[model samples]
Target: MAGLRRGRRPDEQPPEVRMTTLPTGAELLRYVVLVTGVIIAPGADLALVLTSAVRGGRQGGLATTMGIVSGVFVWAALAGAGLAGVLVASATGYLMLRLAGAAYLLFLGIKFLAQSRSVAPPVDRTGGAGKARSFWSYFRRGWVADVMNPKMAVFYLAVLSNFLHPGDFLPGKVFFLALVHASIGLLWFSSISLAVGRSNILARNPRVRRMLNLAGGAVLVLLSIEVALPMQW
Candidate 1:
């Protein structure tokens, strides 16, 4: 014991991190439910997901869903961990992240708009089969995409903070919140997948697809503005 190193050595095995399971209150649950509903209520993330599902087939849509959910995980973690306050308060920090999110949303919106405008029937060249990216890669992409989204980060911080109490129980509350958020994300994304999996009616028609793309693009642009600009409302 006397000779043993106090700190973890480069090759030494790391201590196992304990994962605690804690219960939450109705208020927290309610917040989670409300946020889920809010997210479901017509926004760019959902729109892009639905469009991806419609155009790219099941995996593409699934990838987008996974990405979106991953984002929820990031946002929830940030909110729960106390980083959200700093993110929302500092003009420089907030603006930087906000702009990054806005740029991403804008790019996605423009890309979809371009896709919608193409004269030739758009190719689903997500590379016929063999070129499909790794499943994890897509999942990570979705998670990172949402994680980087400032609207969501700020939204959770400003709105969800009301339900959270400052105490030892906070960690537990955040965990529960993350679970609820992720579940909502999966539920919504799966619904899109099932709808597409069910029929070619909406997905196959160029007219419907164009509408979906344009609508999604518009929503994203709106979200971008909301993130980038100050809002009294």
Candidate 2:
């Protein structure tokens, strides 16, 4: 066929066709590593998971994890739509979101402190409407906690922006990145939940339970204060 393109086989392609523009394996690995680091870092999200696990057992922790994962995807969608940037750019919007998150955290901390003072009924370990209700309750808590936190919106905006291509399938790629992040979070938080669930010592010792509640509550209170303080985004 027109001299058969002397020096190249029929199946051979041009140098320009060597690879597609998609993310390479190395780049994907790097992204995974970076996301893993972010997932493992201590933050309000982790605190919420631990507290929920301790209070409600493995199911609670898992539910909360699901909620957080859902929130991550929501943020990703918002970022892909360019709404996250708009919110972050507006000081008043950011302020309101931050304050709302802080207020929720403060309320949770106060509840924990109050709980530490009194012996409430044992968490229902049976399966039924009660269990479903409890699971959804924790799920809502996790969802609200994540949604109210402006930091998450900013984080997704900053991180996902790096991998974005102006003309590519932007939302698909952004969601893929978020899925990676959420997968890491689910595994890590699930392990914590399992471990905390297995620790029956909390059920056995009131003092230890109170101590953990106090510690968890203190951490949330401190985080809330930190969140409320204005910072350069």
Superposed model 2: Cα runs more than 4 Å off? 1-22, 119-121, 125-127, 230-233
- What are the per-residue Cα lDDT tens digits for candidate 2 across 1-233? 65776578868876652323355587689888988887889988888898888778788889998998888888888998999999999989999999999999998888777777765534685879889899899999888998888889888878877777555677567777888888998899899889987887866776776777778888889889989985567
TM-scores vs. true structure, each candidate? 0.76, 0.86
Show how many residue pairs clash in every candidate, following the order shown. Answer: 2, 0
State the C-alpha lDDT per candidate: 0.71, 0.83
List ranges where model 1 is wrong by over 4 Å.
Answer: 1-25, 119-131, 134-141, 166-169
State the number of backbone clashes in model 1: 2
Q: Model 1: per-residue lDDT, tens digit, 204-225?
A: 5778777777777777778778
What's the true lDDT of residue 89 in model 1?
A: 88
